[model samples]
Target: MPKGVVRKALEGFQPYVPGEQPPDGEGWIKLNTNESPLPPSPKVIAAIKEAATDALRLYPSPTAAPAREAIARKFQLDPTRVTVGNGGDELIELCFRAFAGAGDTVAFPTPTYPLFEPLCRLHEAAPSRHPTEAFAELPPSLGPDPSPLKFIVNPNSPTGALFEARDVEAAVAASSGVVAIDEAYVDFAPRSAVDLLNTHDNVLLLRTFSKSYGLAGMRIGFALGSPDLIEALDAVKDSYNVDRLAIVAAAVAIGDDQHHRKVVDEVVKNRTELADALERRGFEVVPSAANFVFVRPPKPAAEVVAALRERKVLVRHYDREPIAGWIRVTVGTREQHEKLLGALKEIL
Candidate 1:
């Protein structure tokens, strides 16, 4: 190692590990990543093709204007209050970069998205763990923290549980710093904290086209908040954060409400069915508002995951806090779920 080669920030930083993608044709069932099993809408594909001409030679719009416009129209927010990113992950990173700095504390509920902690660390900020014991349900013990920045994921990850809106509101109202509410899975849920936008200038609402819009490949997401907050994010974001094809495809995806509705409805339906199936199989399944079911299987999560893998099925396994014994299974097609259930039955 060279002297003075690295910043102190690099010492404790850990990168986020998204759920895995199986190697080509190696697995018959893949449910690890919480990605939609459906393909992107045909409209999105057409837009991508249309934008894929000689335009590839030119740089994409730095601000991703059209996508922001479509997102604003879809969500009934002002265009100026909206900003697009490569993915919801980018927005999370940008939040850290924009408001948080070395030695500042970034607080978030434990066992939520793993990325939040990693991002805080990467930014050389102090990462404080505020734990949620019962599927990320804010306990009576949790209230405002002294941290200058907080990240809360509604319908939190891995555990597949929704944080109550009132709990979030209280946290926002009492906290002193920027409150970022990550609603990446909110489209699958009944309501959003967007209504709180007017009441709290410190709040930033994050949404993604990855899950519900089936645009994970295009990698687009956006944030809504006060115009000033949006401007702050714009100041730090990459000049061409989003590519041309992604901008057009994401816009069409946001504009096509019919397609979004259909996909969400199907995901909700399958989520219920899969949860029920797991319950019937003697697993304790958490009630999920997101597109995945988190369950405590009869066997250890690692054992069950390994068994499923042997049967050509893949589900996420985590060795982390708050849900170490559980597995998060994404809602796939009916046939896919059946295959998963069959494999579990055989393993049991």
Candidate 2:
């Protein structure tokens, strides 16, 4: 195929690049991606192993019915109000498919999930970017923009700062378009925006099993919203967006509340220690409510990350303005923290 064969919308497209995922068993301390240091619940593992049988020849449930029901029970919502996806990323894209279109406007705060901007290009949707000062609050102009779709990444990524629930609700209440509140990191945050669904019909709260559930490899997630919104997503989604194994993992993961709490509690505890260590080392640590800490190192951000990488330590580095000179390190186990701290001490 010729280069010109590509769509005009993505003539020179730049896709979203995830954090460094070096090959496994390579001795790298992977604190770049926010994965739970602990393994998934034993129950989820048992369920996956149990479901992986002759059923492999058959397609999984198209609607991911069992997982939807499980999520509904946890959230105390009707099954019609829930929808499962391959991951939270898929649910985000579904919102674009169901609402925004070519030449349409899609609004979101900046320094959020990098995938949003790339999706805008792929969909030919004009991006209405509202810049935030240090990941503080929802942009005021976002609500009044009247874009067909808007996204608020609560406990926004990279920076790991959780926005106030009232501020998020205010944005949803004021917006004339569909508002997708991405709570992928909400499990580690102090509050959630799920309550907004009751007061506003246009709000959708997206979640994932990848983080707290320790199922990143499973790649499963879900959304909670009015039946109308869920129905729209179901309409645009693939015949079987959530696969058999992933669906099984999601169902059991949501049902194991004890294991879920353990994951969150561990991350929260590790988060405080990681933040304090960074600050004591002269890094300006931003207040974090997510599973990661964002900080401006005393040394150049790029240099620090490169040095750490040389030591088989991985942490995310940012170079764009407003967040330039900043690094985001996921909260890991105490042993991993000591390794990271040692590596940083040598580097700094």
lDDT of 1 by residue, 28-137 (tens): 69788888888788988988988889979999889999999988898788899999999999999999889898889888888788887777767878887887777757
Worst 10 residues of 1 by lDDT: 1-10
- Model 2 agreement with the true structure over 263-324: per-residue lDDT tens digits: 99999999999999999999998899899999999999999999999999999898988788
Global lDDT scores for all candidate models: 0.87, 0.91
C-alpha RMSD in Å of predicted model 2 compared with the true structure: 1.1
Highest TM-score scorer: 2
**Pairs clashing within candidate 2:** none
Error of 2 at 93 (Å): 0.7
Candidate 2 displacement at residue 221 in angstroms: 0.4
Quote the lDDT for 56 in model 2: 88
Candidate 1 yields a Cα-based lDDT of 0.87
Q: Candidate 2: misplaced stretches above 4 Å? A: none
